[model samples]
Target: MSNCSFCQVIDETLRPGGIAIWLMKEAKEDIKYQVPFLLAVYLDENVYNGALNFNPWRWMEPENEEKRNRRTSPFYAPFGGGARFCPGAELARFYIALFFYYFETTYR
Candidate 1:
């Protein structure tokens, strides 16, 4: 149940032979679909906090473009990635954050 797309590599439940699509660095310009791109790198310093902190501002700060890039950087894809990415991903994140906010504040 990890939120990282990189963690998907260590996930054992995905179907075998399943292929993920992505835009490669040097993909053929003529055929966009043919581009070979798929990845994850959540452990990077700028990507995640190494499970050390839960500062939502790392992602929610309006002036921090670098931190915001993490949203679409494939380092964290609670919804999904590539063309198959969920359109409601942001809404889903909002609900999840809401749930956590209430659960933490109320249950505490």
Candidate 2:
């Protein structure tokens, strides 16, 4: 995913809680809430070095790409994750790519 996509995922304040409401398994107290995964992880300094800053070049590093290949990588999901992954992920990416192509080619 591009840096724009990452930013969108991390900075979506409209969905302050998250994309979905989840209910936990049986416990002493019932808890239901939206787990804003990207936003939460993005705030953690230890996770992505200077995660607060927008550094597109970070994605180019071999270590970052390798982390992406791992299913457990916390920062890998631009379109959400697991069984509830977004259905429009591919279409969204295509549009973003198309826009980026034009922007990069046409910009001064």
Candidate 3:
């Protein structure tokens, strides 16, 4: 019941502070990351539900779209965000698309 990004790469042999793109505001009031923050927490249930369960239809629904608050709703941002966003994100997606396309054509 988890789709955690940190956990995903845990088996891939990523050492601590290896790919340090993920960052978030510190809860320590005045303190913040001088380098990169390693963990990001979501204190709501819906975000977890979105990832734990597979419901692709929610993404296409207008009702769900309007209710999507980043803090509580489910959204997939596999790569980190802003300046640290994965430069290979597009490349990864492209490879996935090609794999599916080839698989479908071959198997169809």
Which candidate number maximizes TM-score? 2
Model 1 bad stretches (over 4 Å): 1-40, 45-57, 60-64
Q: Compute each candidate's TM-score over C-alphas.
A: 0.38, 0.57, 0.45
The Cα RMSD in angstroms, rounded to one decimal, for candidate 1 relative to the true structure is: 10.2
What lDDT, from 0 to 1, does candidate 2 have? 0.51
Point out the higher-scoring one by TM-score: 2 or 3: 2
lDDT of 1: 0.41
Q: State the number of backbone clashes in model 1.
A: 0
Number of clashing residue pairs, candidate 3: 0
lDDT of 3 at 7: 28
**Each prediction's whole-model lDDT (CA):** 0.41, 0.51, 0.40
Which numbered prediction scores highest in lDDT against the true structure? 2
Candidate 3 structure quality by residue, lDDT tens digits, 2-98: 2333223321122112244354554757664475433232222443334333344443455444333322322333455456567885566456556
**lDDT tens digits by residue: candidate 2, 1-108:** 344544343333212233433323345776765545466664466666676666555555676665443134455554566775678866665676677678779999
**Model 1, 36: alpha-carbon shift in Å?**
12
lDDT of 1 by residue, 42-74 (tens): 334454554243343344334333423323544
Alpha-carbon error at 7 in model 3, in Å?
24
> Which 10 residues in a row give candidate 1 its minimum summed lDDT?
9-18
